[model samples]
Target: MIITTSTAGRCPTCGAATVSVDDAEPWCAGCEWNLDAYDRQRRAPEFGWAWVDRWSHRLGYRLTRRQFTHLAGRPLGTGGRSAAAMVTAGVSVLLIGAVLALAVTGVWLIVAFPFPNVAVLLGVALLGLAVALRPRFGRLDPELEVLSADRAPELFALVDEVAAAIGTPRPQVIGVNGDLNAYATAVGLRRRRVLCLGLPWWGALSPPERVALLGHELGHFGNGDPRRMVLTQPAFTMLGSAADLVRPVDTVAGGGIIEMIGEALGKAFQWMLSRLLFGVHLVLVAVALRDSQRAEYLADEMSARVAGIDAATSLLDTALGHESVALAVRREMRAGHGPGRWRSAVAESRAAAGGRLSLLRQLSVREESSLFSSHPPSGLRRRMLAERPRHDPLVVLTEERAARIDAELAKEYEQIRRAVAWSG
Candidate 1:
């Protein structure tokens, strides 16, 4: 609960002791300086007990710091035995062994059968080459930004306020030059960072809505499980690469001579290796993604705990509204040969909408058939949000109250869209 002081205090700017709530701007009688600003700047420090209360209230479920640390920092493993590090090391050893075996076998086969064995060697070489080059093609540039001087003040202040309220460390704030979206990286050796992108539509979000979003990101940071995600990312990448390579092989082979030849010539070895790797990847991804959805749910709860569930819920409504508008614009642009400016607007609109919708879906849905989906179902998130108590403070910050914020955002998004359309 937030505490407000009933007694008037002296204003620092005006050096006036006589200041009351009755005054229009709460200025000091002696000096014309704004007392409200002074009070805000010089508010009394929060009590320790208050922090304890806030944290206890916010984290409805009992979780120890040790458990949080373990969840957030645990390494991925294979078959409940070898960790990701161990698996990586094991893969390296297997790769070396395979290379040695190929070299020895290739030389023998070339000496014995010449042509067929030579062809087999070439195929294996090409396959291995593709696997090695896969990383180069698949690298994803960090969609997140490192915080800069310009954004530091506002973003940091917001983080500090929210973090203090929730009794957690303020996460590092990063900006992305993308559509309306933000995500929190786990606490690393470096500070935890919350990445936000520049979305014209985001400008339309009310302060409460924005705070709710921030709260969600903070939830991820506080969970401290982002590190585990970071650790497991490589496994995901490898699995994806292997899957990509295998699909073409499976298509070409149709379980026939090519498959038989490949299998005889260590293609079977590679396939077995890939399957093992993929199995581990699948397990890690499932756990990580499930944890991610949980993080979102926890964040929603935390946001409600701090700002009120209503605020968080309204924020979702606004997000959905923005997505709907953006999608409409994209459909229009696709139909017409819109200008270059409109193209970016259309792209951004789609991204903002899509990202939020994806997040919402992830939170709501329990089962997903898509292997590539990184988030839970939105319907589930909405349901969870809806289930919270009506008296929740966040609920008080209704969607109806967010109209002006939404309008401002819509106008900005539309401006970009119109500019692009006109140019096109």
Candidate 2:
């Protein structure tokens, strides 16, 4: 006689009633547990999947199971090696090139019979010195701690979550006393590391806003280009320093036959080297900047995926407004037009002009010289994000929730301002 048992029952753990059992033992094969024990474990938090769904609709594409897997499981350095490895490789290449150049020069000098060994030696020494100093100069400064003592726990939790999501190590957190701004620095492996959140950031931003900011920084970690900055930046600095040193030496030393020959060769070699290095640096910087910008976009998407797009957008807007107000105050001080009264006047002017201009553009134009811009214009960034497709499921909910939050925050801010004015 053959006995076949039907599989059926409710899972006590997750509260789904399609559980199965075999041989008189209570079990849920789907959830992988005995029905009795499964019922005792608490349910996980509701993921707010409805919000995510609405966002997916707004984004114009549903995240299929495969896509979701890709998002969650994809390594930070998906396309290639990590930033640290890339930097190490670049420096290695530079070293190899220097060695090859010296080898060729030595061979030519030996064969040609007329060339001075001293000149070739000097060239080799200079190259060696530059390579030797590369690591020291390239390393990023330690990140200044930016968060207040009180907010450290919250900040760490956010950093951990974002880091885990992006599959990069959580960066060292630092508190800075500055009134504005947060940045990541690639100080080399086992060194200062990434993600310095400003204290002002904590005071100014809400919890969701802070999460958005962390997502942005995580995007940087995901791209792994910060390490490139750590690697190449020192070479550029050393090259510039070498040029400065050589120029002054040539000027002070009169052109005796040896000096004249050395000067001529050195100047020519330096000129060509400078141009070549500068061109290479420029290309690399441009590529890095483009990647950095895209990283920001990706981060925004991730933040939306986790928290909701409206939260990310609101965070951007608030950060933008804070930046604008700070800029206005700085301009007033710089123009010798301050005394608190002028600051107030400038703030009023900024408010009247509206806060819709691209923050990235404003930051680049106002803060960075053209020679060292590591980011694209803010206007372009804003336009890209604004136009990009969003997930649809969370669209209505995200927009509605964001609007309500914004309105409430605006009211509170207004009241705070009024109270400050009254006190003053």
lDDT of each: 0.47, 0.46
Q: Which candidate is the best by lDDT?
A: 1
Candidate 1 residues 147-189, lDDT tens each? Answer: 5545345555565666776665665555543354556554342
RMSD of each: 20.2, 21.2
List model 2 lDDT by residue over 269-310, tens digit each.
877766665555544543344344435545666555444565
Per-model TM against the reference: 0.47, 0.50
Q: In model 1, how large is the Cα lDDT of residue 413? A: 45
Off by over 4 Å in 1: 1-152, 186-192, 226-264, 320-323, 328-374, 389-424
* Error at 255, model 2, angstroms: 6.8
Task: Say which candidate scores most in TM-score.
Answer: 2
